[model samples]
Target chain A: MIEFKDVNFSVDNKIILENIDLTITTNEFVAIIGPNGAGKSTLIKILLNLIPNYTGQVFIEGKLNSEWLKTERIGYLPQKEEYDTKFPATVMDIALMGIAANKGVFARFNKQDKLKAMETLDKVGIKQFNNAQIGSLSGGEWQRLMLARALLTGSRYLILDEPEASIDKSGVNSFFDLLSELHKQGKTIITISHDLHMLNKYCTFLVCLNKTLHCHTETEMLTADHIKNTFGEALKLIEKDY
Target chain B: MLSYAFLIHALLGALLSGISLAILSPFVTLKKIAYMGEALSHIAFAGIALALLLSLNLSLVTMLFVLAVAGLIGFVSRFFQTEETNVITIFLSVAMALGIILISAKKDYSFDLASYLFGNVLLINKTDIYSLIVLSVVNISFITLLFKELFYMTYNMTVAEVFGIRVKTVYYLFLFLLAINIVVAVKIAGVILVTAQLVLPASIAFQYVRKLKPAIIISILVALVASLIGFYISWQFNLPTGAVIVLVEFMLYLLSLIINKRSKVRN
Candidate 1:
C-alpha cells in the first residue's frame, strides 16, 4: 500500500504538483494519466524517494518512503531513454543486477541467483537473449529485458514509467497482458502511461493528474469530464471517447 | 639497462601502474569520463605545485589535493545543476593557471617542468614502486568488491538509485579513486599519457569483445602488454617511456580496428 498526503512539488518555483492526496491499496492496478509535463513521473519519483525535497508525506507499506527504502525493495522500470544502451553488458549481466540490488555489497551471485535470473528472463520471453549483448537488443526486446529486471526484484510493488512508449503494437499488448497477470498475482502496480485504451482495459483504478489531483476513482467510474478536467480542453477528443 | 636499479624501478613502476589503470579503464571508457581523467590529471598539476611549496610528501599531498578537487567538481555540478563537463573544464583551466602561478611564486624552487609534464623514468625509485603496489591493490580490491554496483551505475545511474544502489556514494567514491589514480599514474605516465591510457585500453578491448567481463580482461591484457613492450622499446632505444607507451597503445588500437573491420567484412 502507498499513500500521499497533500503532496506538493516545485522546481525553480514552478509548481509541478500541488495538493495531491492519493492512496493505492494492495494488489491495485493503478494508472496515472496526464498530458506532457503533468508531473506524473515526478510524483512517482517522490514516492521512490528520488525527489526527497517535496512537501507533505509519502508512505509505502505503512512506513515513510525513506524508511521503506532502507528496509524493502520496489521493482522499478524507468523510461527506455534513461538507459545507456552502449554499455557493454550482456542480458544476463543486467538481469543479475536485480539480485545484486537485494544482496549485501560484497555478496557474490551464486548458482541459485543465476537460476532465478534465468527464470525471470524466461518469464519475460527473453531467455534466449540471456547471453546476448544489451546493445544488440531490439526496442521491444529491450523492453522485455527491462521487464525481466523488474520482475527479478521480487518486490510486491512494481512502478513502471512509460513501458509502452518505444515498443511496437504487438509488444505493447503482450506487455500489458504480463502486467495484468502480475496484478492478478497480487502485486501492487502503479504505472505512468499514455495509452488510455490499454489502461482502461487492465487498470483497476485511474488517477487523473495535471499539476493537481483532478480525479481519483475506479476505472469503470472514470468519466469524460474527469479526463477533460485533468488534461485540459486540448484533450477533448480523448475525453469524448472516454 | 637491466643492471641499473633505476631502470628496474621504472619497469616495475610501469607494470604496476599498467595493471591498476587497466582495471579502471573499462569503467572510464563505458562511463565516457576520459575527459574527467584528463581534467583531473591537469588538476593534479596544482596539487604538485602546492606540495612542493608546502614541503610535504609529493604523492600524498597531490592525492589529497586532487581528491578534494574532484569532490568540489561533484558538489558544484550537483548544486548548480550544471553539466559536469562544464564544471570540469572550468576547474581544469583554473587549476592549470594556479599551478603555473604557484610554481612562479618560488624564487629558487627550480622545478623540472618537463619531467612533470612528460615524466622522467630515471626519477622512479623504491618508494615510487611501493606506492605503485599499494595503488594496484587498492584498484584491484575496489573493482572486485563493487563491480556490480559500478556496472549498475554506469549502465543507468537513475535506475540504479531507484533500485536502492546508493549511486551517489559509489559515484563519489569512484571520483576519489580516479583522483588517486591520476595523482599516482602521473608520476610515471604524466598527464597526457595517463589520459590516453584511461581511454585506449578499454577502447581496444571493446573492438574485440562485446561483454563487460571479457572486455575488462582484454583491456587489462592490452595495458600490460603495451606497458611491457613500451618499456623494453624505450629501454633499448633510449626513448621517452611515457610517449612510447602511448604510441604503442595507439598503434594497438588501430590494429584492433582493422581486425574488427575485417571480421565484419568476412561476416
Candidate 2:
C-alpha cells in the first residue's frame, strides 16, 4: 500500500501541488487525471521520492519512503522524452539495467539475469528486437521496451508517467491491455494518463487532481462534476468523448 | 629512437593515456558533453599557473585545483538547475583569463608555457610513465566496477535515480575522474588538442558500430593505433607529437565517415 498525508509541493514560492491526501491499496489500478500544468507529474515525482522538499509524509508498504527505498525498489516508466533514444545501447543492454540497483557495485549480470530480462522482453512482445539498437525502435516499440524494463524490476508496484503520449491508438490499446494483465497478476499500478475512456475501462480507482486532490473514488463512481471540477474549460471536450 | 630511454618513456606514456582516455570517450560522447574535455583542460591551465606562481609541485596542485573546479561545476549546475553547457562555458573563460593573468604576474616565471600548449611527448620521464600507469588502473577499475551504473545514468539519469541507482554520486565521481584525466593527458595532447583525443576515437567508433561495447573496443583500438603512428612520425620528423596525433585521429574519423557512407549506399 502507498499513502500520502497532507502532501504539498512548491517551487519559487509558487504552489505546484497542495493538500494532496491519497491512498493506493494493493492490486489497485489507479489513474491520476488532470489538465496540463495541473501538478500531475509533480505528484508522481513526490511519490517516487524525486521531489525531496515537499511538505508531507509518504509511506510505502507501511514504511517511510526513504526507508522503503533503501530496502525496496519501484518499477518506474518515465516520459519517453526524458531519456536519450540515440544512446548506443542495445535493447538487452537497457533491459539489463532494470536489475542494476539490486546488484552490488562490483557484481556482474549473470546468465539468470539475462534469461529474466529476455523473458520480460518476450512478455512485452519485443523479444525479437533483443539485439536491436534502441534508436531503431518505433515509438510504440520503444514504449514496449520501457515497459519491459519496468517489469524486469520485479516490483509489485509500478508507476508510469504519460506512457501513451507518443504511441498510436492501437499501441495505446495494447499497452493498456498489458497493464490490465499486470494488474490481474496482483501488481498495484499507479499511472498518470490523459485517456479518460481507457481509464474508465481499466482503472479500478480514479484520483482527479488539478494542483489539489479534487476527488478520489472508484472509477465506476466518478461523475461528470468531478471532471468539470478538475478541467474546467476542457470538460466539454472530455464530455463529448463520454 | 627505440634505444633512447626518453623515447621509450614517451611511447609508454602514450600507450597508457591513450587506453585510459579511450575508455572514457564513449561516455563523454554519448552524454553530449564533448566540450567538457576542452573546458576542464582550460581549467587545469589556471591550476598550472597557480602552481607555477606558488613554487609548488605542479602535478599535485594542478590535480587538486582541477578536481575542486570540476566539483564546483557539478555543484553549481545541479543546485541552480542551469544548463550544464552554460556553466562549463562560463568557467572555461574565467579559468583561461585567470591562467594568463597569473602567468603575467610572475615576471621571472620562465616555465615553458609552449610545452604545455602544444605538448612535448619526447620529454616524458619515468615519473610521467608511473603517473600514466596509475591513471590507467584507476580509470579501468572505476569503469569496470561501476559499468552498469554508469551505463544506466548515461542513458537516462531520471530512470536510474528512480530505480535507486545513485545518479548524483556517479555524476560527481565521473566529473572528478574527467578532471584527473584531463590534467594527466595535458602532458601528451596539450590543452589545445586534449578534447580531440577524448572525443575523436569515440566519434570514429560510433560511425562504425551501433553497439556500445563494440564501440568502446573500437575506440580503444583507434586511439592506440593513432598514438603509435603519431609517436613514430613525430620522432622521425621532429613535428609536435600532440598535433600529429590529433591529425591522425582526424584522418581516421574522415575515413570512418567515408566507409560508413559506402556501407549505407551498398545496403
Candidate 3:
C-alpha cells in the first residue's frame, strides 16, 4: 500500500500537480483519469516516491519512503517506451528483465525462467514473434510485448500509463482482459489514462485529476461536477467501437 | 620500431579509453545526453588554459582544473538549468574563450597546437599513463556502484525517482564519470576528438544489439579494436595518431552501416 499526503510538484517553475492526496489499498485497481496536461502522470510518479524534492510526505507501508527499499514489488510500463526494435533482441530476452530483477545480474536464467517468459508472451499472443526484432512489431504489437513483460514480472503492484492509447480495439480488449485476470490473481494495479471506456470494466477506483485530485469509487458514477473538476469540459464519449 | 616507447603508451591509452567509454556509453546514449562528453571536453580545455595562465604544469593543471570545471558544470547543469544543451553550450563557449586568451598571452607555447588538437602518441609520457589508470578506475567504480540507478534513470527518470533512486545524484555521478573519461583521454585523442569515444562506440553497438548489456559489450570491443589498429597505422605510416583513430572509428561505423543494410535486404 502507498500513500501521498499534500504533494505538490513543479517543473521549470510551472506548477504541474498540487495539494494531491492519494492512497492505494491492497489489490485495488486505481485508474487515474484526466484530460491531457492534467498531471495524471505526476500523481503516479509521486506514489512511487520518485520526486522527493517536491513538497510533501510520502509513506510506503506507513514508513518514510526513504526507509523503504524499492523491491521488485512494483512493475512499470511507460507510455512510449522506445526500444532499438531494430536492435536484435528477442521477446524472451526482454522478458528476462523481470528475471534480472529477482536474480542478481550475474545469475543465469534457468529453465523455469525461460518457460515463464514464454508463457507470458504466449498469453499476450506474441509467443510466435519471440525471436522477432522488437522494432519490426507494429504499435499494437509492441504494446502487447510490454504487457507480456509486466505480467512476467509477477509484480504485486503494476503501474501502466496509457496501455490502450495506441493499441487497436482487439488488442485493447485483450489487454483489459489480461488486467482483469491479473487482478483476480491479487495483483495491485495503478494506471493513468484518459480512456474511460477501456477502463470502465476493470477499474474499481478512479482519481479524477487536473492539478487537484478527487477520488471516487467506480460505481459511485462520474458526475457533471466531477467531469468539470477533472477535465474542464464535457466528457466526450467518442467511440471507436474500441 | 620497437624502440618507440611513447607509441606503446599512446596505443594503450587509446585502447583503455575506447574500451571503457564503450562500456559506459550505452547509459549515456540511452538518455540522449551523450553531449556530456563535449561539455566535459571543453571544461578540460579550460583547465589547460587555467594552467597556462597560472604558469603551472600543463598536464597537472589540465587534469585537475578540467575535473573541477567539469564537476562545476555538471552540478550547475543538472540542478540549476533545465536545458542541458543550452548550459553546456554556454560553458563550452566560456572554455574556448579562456583557451584562446591564455594561448595568446603566453610567449613560449610548447608543441604545435595540432598534436594537442588531435592526439600525439609520440608525446605520451609516464604522467599521462598514470592519470589514465587513476581516472579509469574512478569512472568504472562509479558505474559499478550505481549500475541500478543508471539503468533505472535511463529507462525512465520520473519513475526511477519514485522508486527512491536519486535522479539528480545519478545525473551528477554520470557527468563526473564522463568528465573523468575526457580528462584521461587528452593524451590519446585530445579534447576536440573526445566525442568519438562517447558517441561513436555506443551508436555502433546500438546498430547491432538491443539489450543494454550487449550493446555496451560490443561498443567496448569495437572501440578497443579501433584504437589499437588506428595507433598501429599511425605508427607504421608516420601519421598523426589522433586523426588515424578517428578515421578508424568512422570506418567501423560505416562497416556497421553496410552490414545493417545488407541484413535489412535479406530480412
Candidate 4:
C-alpha cells in the first residue's frame, strides 16, 4: 500500500503537484490519468524516491517510501527509453536485470536466477526470443520483454509508466490480460496511462490528476466531468456492456 | 625490438592501458558520456599542470585532482538536474584554461608539457607499469562484479534506483574508477588522445556483439591487438605511439562498421 499526504512538488518554483493526497491499497489496480505536464509521472517519481526534494510525506506500507524501498521490492518499467540499438544486450540479459536487487551488486546470477528469468520470459510470451538481441525486438516484443523484466524479481507491487506506449493495439489486449492475471494473483499495480477507456476497463481505481488531485475514486465513478476537470476538456465516454 | 627495455615498458604499458580503457569503454559509450571522458582528460591536463607547477608527483597529484573533479562532476550532474555534457564542457574549458595559466605562471617550467599532451610511451617506467597493472586489475574487477548494475543503470537510472541498486554509490564509484584510469592512461595515450582508448574499442565491439559479456571480451581483445599493431608500426616508422594507436583504433572501428554493414546486407 502507498499513501501520499499533502505532497507538493515544484520545479523552479512552478508547482508540479500541489497539495496532493492519495492512497493506493494492496492488490488494487490503479491507473493515473491526466493530460501532458499533469504531474502523473512526477507522482510516480516521488513514490520511487527518484525525486526526493518534494515537500510532503509519502508512505509505502506504513513507512516512508524511501524506507520502504530500502526494505521492499517494487517492480518498475520506465517510460519507453531511447536506448542505443547497438547496446550489446540480449533479451535474457535485459530481463535478468529485474532480479538484480535480489542478486546484489557482487553476486553472479545463479542457475536458479537464470531459470526464473526464462520462466518469466515465457510468461510474457517472449521465451523463444530470450537469446535474441533486445534491439532486434519489435516494439510489442520489446514491451513484453520489459514486462518480463519487471516480473522477474517476484515483486509484490508493479509500477509502470506509459506501459502502453510501445505496445501495439493487439499486444495491448494481451498485456492488459497479463496484468489482470497478476492483479487476480494479488499484486498491486500502479500505472500512468492516457487511454482512459482501457484504464477504466481493467483498473479498479482511477486517479485523475492535473497539477492537483481532481478525483480519486473507483473506476465507475470517473465520469466525463472528472475527465473535463482533470484534462481541461470534456469528451464523451463510450458505453459498453460487459 | 622486444630486447629494448624501454620498448618493452611501452609494450606492457600499452597492453595494460588497452585492457582497462577498453573495459571502461562500454560504460562510457553506452551511457553516451564520451564527452565526459573528453572533459576528464582535459581536466587531467590541469592536474598535470598543477603537479608540474608545485613539483609534486605527476601521477599521484593528477589522480587526486581528477578524482575530486570527477566526483564533483557526477554530483553536480545528478543532483542539479543539469545536462552532464554541458557540465563536462564547462569543466573542460575551465580546466584547460586553468592548466595553461598555471603552466605559464611558473617562470622555471622545466617539464615538457608536450609529452603529457601528445604522450611519450618510451618514457613509461617500471612504476608506471606497476600502477597500470594494479589499476587495471581493480577496475576490471569492480566492473565485473557490478556489471549488471552498471548495465541497468546505463539503460535506465530511474528503474535501476527503484530496484534498489544504490545508483549514487555505483555512479560515484564509476566516476572514480574512470578518473583513476584516465590518470593511469594519460601517461601512455596523453590527455588529448586518451578518449579513443576509452571509446573506440567498445564501439567496435558493439558493432559485432549482441551481449555485454562478449562485447567486453571482444573490446579487450580489440584493444590488445590494436595496441600491439600500433606499437609495432610506431617502432618501425618511428611515429608517435599515442597517435598511432588511436589511428589504428579508428581504422578498426571503421573496419567493424563495414563488416557489420556487409553482414546486414548478406542477411
Candidate 1 lDDT over A96-172, as tens digits, reads 87777677686778899999999999988999999888878998888888778878888998999989877888889
Per residue, candidate 2 scores C-alpha lDDT tens digits across B1-267 of 656877788888877778889999998998878798899899888998999999998889999988888879879999999998999899999999999999999999887898877777865788888888888889888888888878887887877877777776888788789888889888888888899999999999999887777888899999999999998998889899888988999999999999999999999
Interface RMSD of each: 1.6, 1.5, 5.3, 1.8
Positional deviation of residue B1's Cα in model 1 after best superposition, in angstroms:
9.1
TM-score of chain A of each: 0.95, 0.96, 0.90, 0.94
**Order the candidates by lDDT, highest first — what do you get?**
2, 1, 4, 3
lDDT of 2 by residue, A86-105 (tens): 67788898888788878857
**Cα RMSDs, all models:** 2.2, 2.1, 4.1, 2.9
- B1-267: candidate 4 lDDT, tens digit per residue: 545888789999988988899988888888887887888899999999999899999888998888888778768998998997788888899999999999999999987787889788977999989988898889888988887778887876766777776666887788778888888888889989999899999899988876677788889999999999999999999999988999999999999999999999999
Rate residue A159 of model 2 by lDDT: 90
- Candidate maximizing DockQ: 2
lDDT of 4 at A200: 71
Which has the better DockQ: candidate 1, or candidate 4?
1
What 10-residue stretch in candidate 4 chain B is worst by lDDT?
B158-167
- Which parts of model 4 are misplaced by more than 4 Å? A222-224, A232-242, B1-3, B72-82
Between candidates 1 and 3, the one scoring higher on lDDT is: 1
Q: Can you write out model 3's per-residue Cα lDDT over B28-125, one digit (the tens) per residue?
A: 78887767777777777767767766788876787687777666665887788567578778888898788878877777876466666676666667
Q: What interface RMSD, in Å and to 1 decimal, does model 3 have?
A: 5.3
Backbone Cα, N, C clashes tallied per candidate = 0, 0, 5, 0
Candidate 3 lDDT (Cα, whole model)?
0.73
